[model samples]
Target chain A: MGHYWQEISALTMRWVRRLSREKFSMLFTLVQPMLFWLIFFGNLFQRAADTQVMQAPNYISFLAAGVVVMTVLNNGLAGGVDLLFDKENGFLERLMSTPIHRTSVILSRFIFVMAITSMQVLVILGVAYLFGVQPATGILGVAMILLIGMMFGVGLTAISMAMAFSVKSHGDFFSVLGFLSLPMIFLSSALVPLTAMPGWMSVLAQFNPMTWAIDAVRPLILSGWTEALPHVGMVVLVMIVFDALCLYGGAKAFRRAMG
Target chain B: MDRTIAIDVSHLSKTYDSYRAVDDLSFQVYAGEIFGLLGPNGAGKSTTLRTLITLLHPTSGTATVMGHDTVRDADKVRTLIGYVPQERAIDRFLTGREHLQLLGALYHLTKEEAAKRIAELLKLVELEAHADRPAKTYSGGMKRKLDIACGLLPDPKVLFLDEPTLGLDVQSRLRIWEYVRMLKARGMTIVMTTNYLDEADQLCDRLAIIDGGKIKTLGSPVELKIALGGDIVSLTLKETGRISSLESDLTGRPAIKTVRATPKGLDIRVESPEKALPAILESANRLGCNIEFIQYNRPRLDDVFIAHTGRAITESIPESETV
Candidate 1:
């Protein structure tokens, strides 16, 4: 049991070290969401998006939650590219031939991806603060937003990791990633609220776990604890079920690939 | 040499769907000897090593390492073996020191033990000066050395090297051979696979020549060569059409044991080349076969491969599509 955690920590630290060395990827990961989505897109749609419909003082404040969840979504979805590279380069095969616990490989990836997602989420929130968008629920609400983002991230990362193991190559994994992420972002209340969408699109958005996550976090940023708490419970429930399914499928894929 | 067995594989077969990558193969590797699996690509050499290392389970039959079953006691088997695959497995982002540290941790080495071992391996592979640099900056030979260092992190009893010197330059190949020899001197059992005939002849204590997922022959390099009987007299005829006539004429000669026709020549095995040479020349002259070149020397591993498989080891066998 002790060896299990030690192996996980060692593997996790490898990911952290690799990320730290990639100056461009690290800088891009933290800055892209703030520059394009938050500042440019937020200002572009600022006057057009009605504050009353968005249920906030301004579009920037409403878009903060969307950006946070979207960062988590993007980070979570692309989490497995490193593992895929390892598989191709024969690093994973080297790891498997060792005496370490098999589950350590999967668990270490989860821990590393979530840690990076949290850092990105914090950076997005800090940038949104520059736009005069403060969380109405204060520091605890900031914590809750990160919590919700992580909850949403768990299932997405699981699915991504599964695809990393299941697919033949990185190209195949990216194609599936693009197909899943674009439709998911458009279908949710990420860029636009559900009420403003066409009836069919709004109904589809209701089924997106990203919608549940964004809805839960939007209230925390725009409304106080009382309004946000109920939405948090529903999102938490949805994430638990979502994560269970993803993890189950991911385990199966891992077993097949490992064999 | 101690005769205790380190690895025992019996009737081990691994199949992917209908394709049998490893046919019903069996062999044993004794402790503290460098055993070679000599074969071309896709001859099931890598597959066999992977199975013994517990990376792949045998489809049928069984393999044991240090008395632990490969499938059932895989964890125990892993603790006793280290594998250096053909592919370079180093992380481009991590320094040489970091790669060893991480692998040491995974092998469950204590902090101090890992540090000591890592330092030793770095020096052994002569990467101490460049240990702080990421692998991407290292040359191909350096990357391969780091890979070997990682595999040695666990201080395993047996080391499995899959084509260890496969694309290395002559200097790098010699360095790797020195390291492998040094390991064998420490009484570590080593199993390596290679398609290089010279590598097998120079390094292997005993080797199995495999082809099409089967062991065609097995013995020490010298033994396999000497088994072909006397010296080899290679005669390349100027006229290709006269090779068969010359071969037939040379067959009944007194000192000649076997006469095999080659692409451009006839390879004649003679009990004594000194006596057979003159007679062979007479036969060629009688047959009116114009000789382009003639040479005689002791048999080599390539000749042994030819004797067994009816083709030289250097002859390209179309690689199997399945990995």
Candidate 2:
């Protein structure tokens, strides 16, 4: 067990060091979504949007939760590209040939991606504050939002990792990623409220785990604790089921690739 | 020689779908010796080495390293071996020191032990000056040295190097060869694969020449070369088409053991080149085959490869079949 922890920390630290060295990538990854989606898109839609129908004080406040969840989704889904590159470059093979526990490889990647996602979440929230968005439940509400984002991220990261192991090449992984992310974001209550969406799109959004996550977080950011807790419970249940399936699929792919 | 076997492979084969990458190959490496798998690309050299290191399971039969079965006791086998794969494996963002530190941690070395070992290895591979630089900043030779240093982190009983100098320049290749020799001097058993005949001939104590997923021959470099019996007198004729006619004339000569025709000449294998050269020239003269050049030398590893597989090691194998 001690050895396992040592190996995981060592591997995780490698990711941390690599990220720290990539100053340009780190800057863009943190700033891009906040710049385009939260500020520009929020202000653009602010005048056009029906705040009464959407049930929010303003569009920027409403878009804050969406941007937070979307950051998690985007960062989580793209997490496994590094692992896939390792496989292609033969670093994964070298790691497997060592005496360390094989599970350490997967677990370390999860830790690194999640840690980075949490930091990005905090940065996005800090920027949203400048736009006059605040969680109705205050600091505790912010913590709950982070918990929900992480829960949603767990499943997305698993699916990404499974795709990384199962696909023949990075090109194939990216194609599948593009196909999944756009539809998922558009189909969910991410950019728009479910009440405003078309009847058919709303029905599809009901099935999206992203919609459940966004609906849960929107209330905490725009409404108070009373309205947010029940949705939180529902999103938790959805996350449980979603993560179970993704983790099962991910484990199978990992075995096929590593075994 | 202690002669205790370091690795024993018996009827080991690995197949990918219908294509057999390794075909019932078997050989043994004795303790404290450098063993080479000599072959061309796609000859299953890497497959054989990967299996023995417990990276790939054998499709049939078995392999053991230091008395541990490769598949059944893979973890035990891993602790005892180090592998430097054919492809360069390095994190471009990590410094050379960081790479070794990470490997040390993975290998479960204590902080003090890892530090001591990493310092020793950095000096051994002569990378102490460049240890602080990220691998992306290092030259090809430096990256390779870091890779070799990573493999040596555990101070393994056996080291596996697959094409250690595949893409390096001549100076880098020579430097790597020196490091390999230095490792051998410390009494570690090493298994390496290479398509370069000179690498096998000059570096290996014993080698297996593989072709088409099979071991065509196995012996020490000197033994394999000497097994061809006597010397070779190669006569390059000015006229190419009259080789068969001259071949028949020299076939039954008492001094010559065998006559094999090459693209430019006839390679006459003889018990004594002194006695056979005159007879070979006489036959070509009588046959109106004008000799353009004459070369004579003792049998080399390439001749050994030709004698077994009937082709030089440089002949191409289809790219798709390479592992």
Worst 10 residues of 1 chain A by lDDT: A145-154
Q: After superposition, how far is residue B141 of candidate 2 from its true place, in Å?
A: 0.7
Whole-model lDDT, model 2: 0.91
The model with the greatest DockQ is 1
Question: lDDT, candidate 1, residue B70?
Answer: 92
Docking class of 1: medium
Model 2, B1-323: lDDT tens digits are: 46899999999998988899999999999989999999988899988988988878888999999999999999999999998978889999999999999999999999999999999999989999999988999989888998899889989999999999998999999999999999999999999999999999999999999998999999999889868887878889898999989998899889899999999989888887678888887888788999899989898888999999888988887676665
In the range A93-189, model 1's lDDT, one tens digit per residue, is: 8999999898898889989989889988888888889999888899999898888888888888889989999998789999999999889999999
Q: Write down the DockQ of candidate 2.
A: 0.65
Candidate lDDT scores, in order, read 0.91, 0.91
Residues A88-168 of candidate 2: C-alpha lDDT, one tens digit per residue: 988888898999887898899898888888888888888989888877899999899889888888888999999999999
